[model samples]
Target: MRQNPERRTALLDAAIEVLAREGSRGLTLRAVDKEADVPIGTSSNYFASRDTLLTQAGARVYERLLPDEATVAQQMSSAVGTEGFVYLMREAMTRISGFRTGYLALLELRLEATRRPELREVLTKRVRADMDENVERHLASGLPGDAVSVRLLQLTLSWLILEQLTLPDIMTDEERDELVTEAVLRLSAPSKRE
Candidate 1:
């Protein structure tokens, strides 16, 4: 197998694009090679099998979608109460939605994971780790949510994002923004004293 890290990354990036545009069923080594504009056998040299490519692509999507440290720090600094939680969730929704292709490819990876155990393992681990981190961050940042609230936001916002990505025409941007705000406020509001 080739050991050029740069080339491998390039192929994975291409695979992501192919996955987003073509869905999981259309993902092929030859398709990746074409998308990368490398020789016909280039992707094969970098990846041993279709499963390898699928798993790697799943990892790559998160790698590409992760917010940079500076952004995280900036966002974390401003987080305060319910409003702060609202801002944080809105920012998160914006950031995640901004990378349309990465998220779309991730959707493809999720569909493919059902048929491929290795891919399923990789995605489950990555997603779980991400959720754990988000829960910890929400707790530490003094956001208005408990771990349960954070988890709920994760589920609700994810579906909203899915709707935004797949059938954006269904709702206006302002309506989506309202939904995010409502979810955060309702889910994270302080409980009444007993």
Candidate 2:
């Protein structure tokens, strides 16, 4: 198997584009080759099968979707309290939505996972780990949120993102912004005194 890191990344990125544009049914080695502008058999050298390509493409989406160290440092330095928590969530939403193709590919991977036990196992573990990491980060950041709060906000914002991506006309920008703010405020609030 080819071990050239840069070439592998390029192939995986092309796979992501194909998955996003054509969904799982249309994803093929030839499609990825054309998308990557590589030779017909180039993708096969890096990926042993369509399942491997699909799995790697799913991993690549997370690689692209997660914020880099620099972005995380910047966000952490400026974020404080509930307001900062809201800001963080808004920024996260923006970052995730910005990678439209990556997120769309992720959606396809999720749907595809239903039938592929291997994909389901990998995706379930990855998503669970991501959620756990988010919970730990929220607790450490002094963001006025507990683990449940973080989990709740994650679930709600994900749906909002789906709406934004698939049906932009359903909600105006202001409405979405307000929803983000409200979700953070309500989810992260401390329990009332007995």
Candidate 2 per-residue lDDT, tens place, 48-77, comes to 999999888888898999988898878987
Instruction: Give per-residue CA lDDT, model 1, range 32-116, as digits (tens).
Output: 9999999999999999999999999999999888888898888998888888888888888898899998999999999999999
How many backbone clashes can be found in candidate 2?
Answer: 0
Judge candidate 1 against the unseen true structure and give its global Cα lDDT, from 0 to 1.
Answer: 0.92
What lDDT score belongs to each candidate, Candidate 1 first? 0.92, 0.91
TM-score of each: 0.96, 0.96
**Worst 10-residue stretch by lDDT in candidate 1?**
185-194
The pairs that clash in candidate 2 are none
Clashes of each: 0, 0
